[model samples]
Target: MAFVAELSRSVQGRVVLITGAASGIGRATAHVFAREGARVAVTDRAQEDADRVAGEIRAEGGEAVGWALDVADGQAIETVAAAVAERFGGLDILVNNAGTTRVLKIDDGRYDAAWDFLLPILLGSHQRMIRAALPHLRRSEAPRIVNIASTEALGASSPGSIYSAAKAGVTGLTRSLAVELGREGITVNCICPGPIHTGMTAAIPDDNKTIYARRRTALGRYGDPAEVAHAILNFCLPASSYVTGVTLRVDGGLMVRNA
Candidate 1:
């Protein structure tokens, strides 16, 4: 009840857009933001999952809507941005959370495939969405952009993950945009999440998790999607008004050990 009251004071009546809201961190973020009274736009490639997230938020007495989106398509992003503006009267927050990658070494024949797919989804899409959503974001008094990167972006030397390289671009974009948008009173930051216990990492064996915990993480465990969501909510809150253009890592000390 205390947090509920605080939600009303901190996040009530804001319009929020989150990509990749079908599952994992994006889904957790949708719940967190919606609970705090934001009018959440739950968009993902999976129509069923996106609909369910929005439905659940509405069922819980929060304002929400769902749309199937391919973040790699800039035109589609523009269309969705327009729809959100019309439906919500404006936008206050943007969470660019959709991402993917293929594991391929440069020597592999499929390296081009990995590069093409990952770059568009991870970096190109985030940039396009920002361009499409800028006008609506500019209208808000407290506009916030939370670009999701990865701990790999912080120079993790993750040779196994093509996603890591793309995320580095996202981190760069976050820093640059923070400066460009600062004059507009819009705050831009990034979340470089570590190895979270999400669907994408489900294939990692228990042994590997144990090894990673012991060797890499000071916290000695994997992170949860909700944990990353909490960091994201921190950026969107009015209390974080002074924090901008920073990459906050939610990596459970993976970077600390590696660094």
Candidate 2:
């Protein structure tokens, strides 16, 4: 009973705004924050799904609000930021989790259209959302930003060439933002997830996922949403004051040579 209360009060009253909260990692993250008593602002491209997630959180006795947010649209991002701040009175954490996977080859003439569509949601949206939420976040004693990157960022690009490039930019953004925001008591970090089975990966046939897991990951299995959430939650807690500017890979030990 005591443990339960402690867990519940862990992030009590903190305002967390998570983009792409409609499903997958975003939905999982929303549950993580709410379970710990944070007032979560759920925003996604799909308004109905976002609302359902928020409703589920409220039904579970947590505070939350849902808003339709298309990160590709600058104005929509601004509107969501304002609505989130007003709804929660302030914002403490911003999770840039909105992105999509694309199977594209760089040499193909299709590169132009592909880059244009993926860049904004994957890499560009991070800064835009951060700018819109900075004023409110700056007001909080403990502010955090977690950008969701991909393992492809480091690996030689194959399947998602565009996604890989964009995520690499996200990693760069994380480092730069951490250095800049540290003095302001705002910690910035990023996660590189390898083969986490989300809505995106689910589209791939299970046999293919198994083959990839065998080839790439030492753990020989895909991680669950909650597993990634734990790593994210750590950086979010006030206890993580000393930890900043780190790119923690939540992959099941997908080998990427640092040298």
Candidate 3:
């Protein structure tokens, strides 16, 4: 009974700042945390989308605010992080989920462009956001950082090598930061989601998605954004204090299948 009560109140009243919260996994994460009574800062590159999501949360009677944030921009990161910390009184959870995808062959003309564009947003932003939120997180009783990586980090798909590389960097960053901040009782972790139905995959044909998921994922289906969100929520719980430096695969056993 005591354990259940403590777990229930674990994340209530904590301030959570999530990047790319306008849609997909980020949007789902914002809703899940808010449902758990966490005050949420919903940020995205698109100001209107961010506003819309935040508004939806407010309509659901959750505490929230929205901001336009380009994770690739250092100034924007610092500003938004500061504003959210101030608005919510302090930051307790940081979910670095802002990201997009670009696929190009190694020899393609746009390969360099894709590299420059993807690396900063996917890999570099995590570091910058963590740095920006470090001060407030240090002040919180149970600070948690959850970086959203992808299954691409473990296995490669043609023309997505760049994306895979960046995600691999996220896992490495999670481990390094976890070790550095563990002494402070700040838990840093990573989530690697596989074949989630997000905007990035919206263009993929339905038949193709089903075939791919059946072959690659043990669950034989692409996961919903909310499924990944729930995993992120679990890591942010105060009860997860002892779990740090863990790179959890929220991908329905996608990596375990040999066939």
Candidate 4:
């Protein structure tokens, strides 16, 4: 087989389930995988948005279906995971990309509420989805688990302590799960995106975004959701069979600077 053809065929006919796929990086990931010929399960807390994304993929000539899933709920994760496996015939890749940003001070009234609200979705949900999808993943010839963490996991931002902690936990979970599932051929990995132009960062002014990118990242610009989506795609490719437990930073060189 030709090298390029083999690479292109790697992810073809695979089944991929992505959480929080209604918008941002998750949405981009859904489209990318579907374009690569994967049957996609587009899931989110908002049913309409999820369905809209699925519809868009179908209009683009890809196989996809939408499901309303609240990742924070363990039972919901199990139910959705099973339904996706059944709908798509079987599961192959699971992307835990559902999350939000919350900044809270230790003395704030909502500090405890922030922890309660964020941890379950950002950290716990990854574990829940992995467990729920493990059975189906084990049946596949090339199974993969990609957990979407954030650069916050590697560095600290004031008042984002809780969010950072939760994301950090995600990377830890990825490493541990990778070791446990290595012998089974299920590769687990983590992606930490930085300065992405997503809904979470939409509130930041353009000027500030520019200045931050210039001063921080080596690329000197904010990354698009599709950029991170493609990084996620790399791990899902069958060619990545030997790669596991990797915490990749799709940060446009944000982590490499000291100046």
Candidate 5:
């Protein structure tokens, strides 16, 4: 219990909603928040996985609930957000961590694959979630929205052009929304992680992974999901209210590499 208690600076009693809470960074973030005494609403497309994560949190004497919904669907996002607000009484934090990636070349006729996969979860669903939670967030004294973007946003060309574009859009949304919501006492920010070891990267070929390790990262390894979660918590803290409209990179110093 003491171990979990040390994971937070001031997350106690806050109500947090995190999308893509089944696995990877989202799952890790949920655990981190719950450890800090936050009431967490864990949403994922997979009901079983969501339930498992919620159960784990409950077993640890933390407050948590699981909701299953496809973030790609606007209606589903609205329903989930409303339910969270109604159940929790109010919302203090929103983490838009749901996203999909498709590796298709620009010259390929299937360039739309990335857009079709990413638009709903990455851009559309996040927008809907924020809209639905805005009313409740406005009621809170300190409200925060953290959008998970990627380092690919800084470069025009990438392994997946469409994925890069989608991430770029996420960064843009973060800045624009920060301006729009700042007056409402909500601080909006983006986290652009370079190469985190998540389910999304499990399929990366070993040779390609080695090349990435050598050429891109200064730390000589992929980042852990918890590292990124820590950065998110930093942005969500009350002390960070003035630190808005920025993208904090938690990428093991990968952005500094030219190659």
Candidate 6:
């Protein structure tokens, strides 16, 4: 817990809104942020899971609240943003970590599968959240947005073409928003993670995982959720105000190796 607490640079009293807070990277990030003394708003499509995360935070003596949100819906994002502002006074951080992926090759006669599965969550949801939170973020003294991406955005080409494209769009959005919001005291950045052990990755066949481990990753294992959370915490620090528009890769050197 102390180690986790040290990850954040004293964000005590800051308000953070995290999307996809039900489980996986989002849940892990929420826990890390709460431990570091941030007031967290845990949001997910599943109301029960969101409430559970909020309860765990409260039980640990952290300030937290849960909201059910369909990140793909603009109206829902707007409503949740308003609720967060009213509850926490203002927003300091927005983490666009909600996404979905479907594995389908471009040459397998299923190219559309990628777009159909990833567009709504990756592109649509991120834009909606950013739009909804912009007003409140402008009012805060320090505002940050962290967009989660994948190494595929840089041309990995394993999971699916759609996921790659969507993540690439995320990278683009991070840079664009960083420039658009820099003068307003808002910093935007993206994180590109390699193969991580999460529910989403669990769907991949064991054989494929083994192949990926053997060939791609220099660490010889999938990345832990905490590793990504650590990077997220770094982005939310006030000291990182000048670090916007950059994509930090947390892939354990996988992207550089073609094993």
What's the lDDT for all of these models?
A: 0.89, 0.88, 0.94, 0.95, 0.88, 0.88
User: Would you estimate the TM-scores of all the predictions?
Assistant: 0.93, 0.93, 0.96, 0.96, 0.93, 0.91
- Give the per-residue lDDT of model 3 (tens digit) for 1-259: 5554444446889999999999999999999999999999999998899999999999999999999999999999999999999998999999999999888889999999999999999999999999999999999999999999999998888978899999999999999999999999999999999989999999999999999999988999999999999999999998888899999998878999999
Model 4 spans > 4 angstroms off: 1-9
lDDT by residue (1-259, candidate 6, tens digit) is: 4553323367888899999988888998999999999999999998898999999999999999999998877788999999999999999999999888777767776667657656988887888898899888888777899999988899757657788888999999999989988888799999998888888898888888878787778887788888999899999997777789999999988877755
Clashing pairs in 4: none
Off by over 4 Å in 6: 1-8, 107-117, 205-211
- Which model is ahead, 3 or 6, in terms of lDDT? 3
Candidate 5 — what's its lDDT?
Answer: 0.88
Model 3 quality (TM-score) = 0.96
Shift of residue 131 alpha carbon in model 4, Å: 0.5
Winner on TM-score between 1 and 3 is 3
lDDT of 1 by residue, 107-145 (tens): 888887778877989999999989989999988878999
* Displacement of the residue 142 alpha carbon in candidate 3, Å: 0.5
Which runs in model 2 stand beyond 4 Å of their true positions?
Answer: 1-9, 256-259
On a 0 to 100 scale, what is the lDDT of residue 185 in model 2?
90
Predicted candidate 2 versus true structure: per-residue lDDT over 1-259, tens digit per residue: 4553222226788999999988889999999899988999999988898899999999999988899899999998888898888877889999999998677787888888989998999999999999999999899878889999988887855657788889999999999999999899999999988789899888789999898787777888888988888788888988777678899998888855222
lDDT of 3 at 70: 94
Q: Model 1 — TM-score against the truth?
A: 0.93
Tens-place lDDT digits, model 4, residues 1-259 = 7565344336889999999999999999999999999999999998999999999999999999999999999999999999999988999999999998788888999899889999999999999999999999999999999999999999988989999999999999999999999999999999999999999999999999999999999999999999999999999988888899999999989999987
